[model samples]
Target: MNTTDNTPSNIVRNFMTALDSNELDTAANFLADDFVFSGWTPKPLNKQAFLTLLENIKEGIPGLSFNIHNVLEQNTSITGTIQVQGYQTDSFIIPALGTPPIPQTASSVSLPMEEVTYRLHDDLITAMDVEHTTGGGISGLLKQLGIELPLAQ
Candidate 1:
């Protein structure tokens, strides 16, 4: 779906394309210097930190692909759901959110996630919030951590 506010959606689409192409530098260029992330690994990541985190994810999954299925836009904000599929080869955690020490890469796990982004002036993404679609996340991950997240459904 498309949003009336085309700018935000355009930015989001461009960013997603960069991610699908594994262009870390290009993706970072679209984010604000002080982008904020909720329910995402490394919450409140500055430009450098966010870039580093993306690099790490790329390292774990060399061929990462992001497929955005829905997009809703209002004013300067845009929200959508994206499906991520890739191969993981290391052990990494999404820091402070979700299960930690997660396997770097696995078979094409289909994770449906919600993403909300606020545009900076009409340009970069100044803030963002991301969350998993499932109410009960991975069994072992939460079981070992002994924590529960609010269900998306």
Candidate 2:
């Protein structure tokens, strides 16, 4: 009930700040216990599961960073696009891909700007949705790791 500039953009900014600083606990504060995440995975992820995914990404990708382009707030929703840049420092499996683990290449990959939307309730993020705007999707990411997938016929 602390209504002092508690805009959706502010909440998301605070969350991203904490995440960028590797302060996972602080970032979690912005999320509701029943938080739901969509688009990033094949199935919706709960709050704890989302946190674990972030930790796994951090561990597998060194120097991972997000360059936020813009934040738009409307009512209880906040939307934005960001460019994710990083290099795979260790092998990791992308569950959504349903493929073998991606081995490390130490080469950098710059994902095209991807849009994300957050729904907030009571100033806590209740849900999040991501849209992969890039055309290549995970294929581009895998290529950076020196792994090529056969073109679909």
| Colliding pairs, model 2 | none
TM-score of each: 0.67, 0.79
Model 2: how far residue 8 lies from native, Å: 1.6
Q: Candidates' lDDT values, in order?
A: 0.60, 0.74
lDDT tens string, model 2, 6-115?
A: 87898998887777666889989999999998765546789987877677666667566766659999999999886767877887765534546677667788877778
TM-score of structure candidate 1: 0.67
lDDT string for model 1 (96-150, tens) is 2443455533544444454544555557888766664443123323332333422
Please provide the root mean square deviation of candidate 1 (C-alpha atoms, Å).
6.1
Candidate 1 error regions (>4 Å): 1-6, 89-106, 135-153
For model 1, what is the error of residue 44's alpha carbon versus the real structure, in angstroms, after optimal superposition? 3.2
